[model samples]
Target: MSKYIIIHVFVRIFSNMQENSKDPITQSNEQCSLTMVRRVAAMLDLDSKSFSEGDLLPKGWHFFMLAGETRKSELRSDGFPGLGVPIPDLGLPRLLLGGRTVSYNGDIVIGSVVEKTSFIKSIVEKTTNSGPMAIVTIQHELRPISETSPAIIETQTYILLSASKASNNSEKTLSQPIEAEHQKNIIPDETLIFQYSALGFNSHKIHLDRSYAQNSEGLPDLVVNGGLTTLLLTEYIRTNLGLEITDIKVKHIAPLYCNRPMTLTAKKSETDWKLYVYDNNNDIAVEAEINVK
Candidate 1:
């Protein structure tokens, strides 16, 4: 049978399953631990003593608290813990972080107990040029126990694809160097990748297992976590540019591998800031825009 016919039949079957199913929702509580904050700061080579109890948790730092409490047997075949809520088994094996949007409304203080609610916002299956794939959007809200409103709301988009679609090499041509007002270069090694993955409770083999990344995923090396790249950009804005961000939208354009030097650059405009992360090959890997107060 032709590929289109296969996709059509597959979608029809899944649509029937979806019609009988409901989106999953989950809720949990966690302490905004000062110890956890310090650990994350130390992971980034920052002064752990700089943070203390009652201090407002840094934006984007909530990633650590949003990790799913999935058990060993519940983890996906790729070692991914679902987005706090259960993810439907769509038969697509390879998963990628497509993008995320974060909105900061209130402040979450250290030492405070916060309630997190996560749910599947949407799931759409489609036929792509490459093959059949699905896009899943998961939304999470974190509210301080002492308050009535959520302090942080975030939506993460994940793309699921067939393993046969994995690529071992860059498919696009190298582009010209990107020029920005401020730029920093750093190499992401195994230690950094491992630390970030551990901090976020992300067991995705792409960021942790080299053999799985290479042989299974057809990647050159372990992939860097997209959330880590966003955290770096936000930290740069806060520490280097002295700006307070209110919102951020991030897009992962390409993958950045471990032990490779990636450049972080930011350009300030009248209203917002634009950030770009260039891989070792000088190609844009991540693009983001920050709205500051």
Candidate 2:
């Protein structure tokens, strides 16, 4: 049998298992605490050595990356690749992120416990020239060491990269130019969250463990992850333009914060699409170009 057929069979069996299995409650109303952040951060590879001398990550960022990596792991055990790795079977449900929303309550300090809860919000499937891809949405909530108003809530979109197009450096031939846009929505924040160093399994620290972020990373505060921003931009385009994005490349210019709102801008020139996420302050958080056919 062909590899694609084998992968498709596995995906079918896995999907059936998912449908028959008991649905677990993935969402929580709890506030983010320091302890919870610490545990999750450690698993994600966040540690003390990662911090810079002064500037560092804020609190909410920690919860963001943790939930993302955790979600990836969950999908893998059900028959997919883990985070940062391409999926094996080309026939499996190709998951890709569309966008996310994260609310920030207050700051999480070092040695503090953060209250966190997460849930799967939505899942959708689409057929592309490459194959079938599934979009999975998940939500996460975070709070201060002490319970307070405006707890941070984050929604994330995950895209399971299709295996059919699998190859070393699979994104090489997918490059294109930026499109044009007039009106756009942007989110802004002052102290962007960031990872202190190559601390944890997480190369995306702007999303995890804030202590190192603030004191070590040299960032004003904890910064949001560039990857998350890309996900949001892709999600925005998919919803607004309804285009099948074969590949995307994004470049980060500045950092984003916990509660800040970012704008997503898009335009089309010839056969390519250009998109950007701007911080509320009007700074370019990230820029991306997509090839859609």
What is candidate 1's lDDT per residue for 1-293, written digit by digit as tens? 56554444233222322245465567789888998899899988999999999898887788898987789998889999876787768889889999999999999998899999887777788876778789888888999988988999998999898877376665456678768779999898999888888988999988999998888888988898999999988888888888888999999999999988899999987988888999987888899999999
TM-score for all predictions?
0.91, 0.39
Q: Which lDDT value does model 2 have at 208?
A: 50
Model 2, which residues run further than 4 Å from truth? 1-22, 26-60, 63-96, 148-150, 166-293
Local lDDT at 99 for model 1:
97
User: How many residue-pair clashes does candidate 1 contain?
Assistant: 0
Off by over 4 Å in 1: 1-22, 170-174
Alpha-carbon deviation at 124 in model 2, angstroms: 0.9
lDDT of 2: 0.47
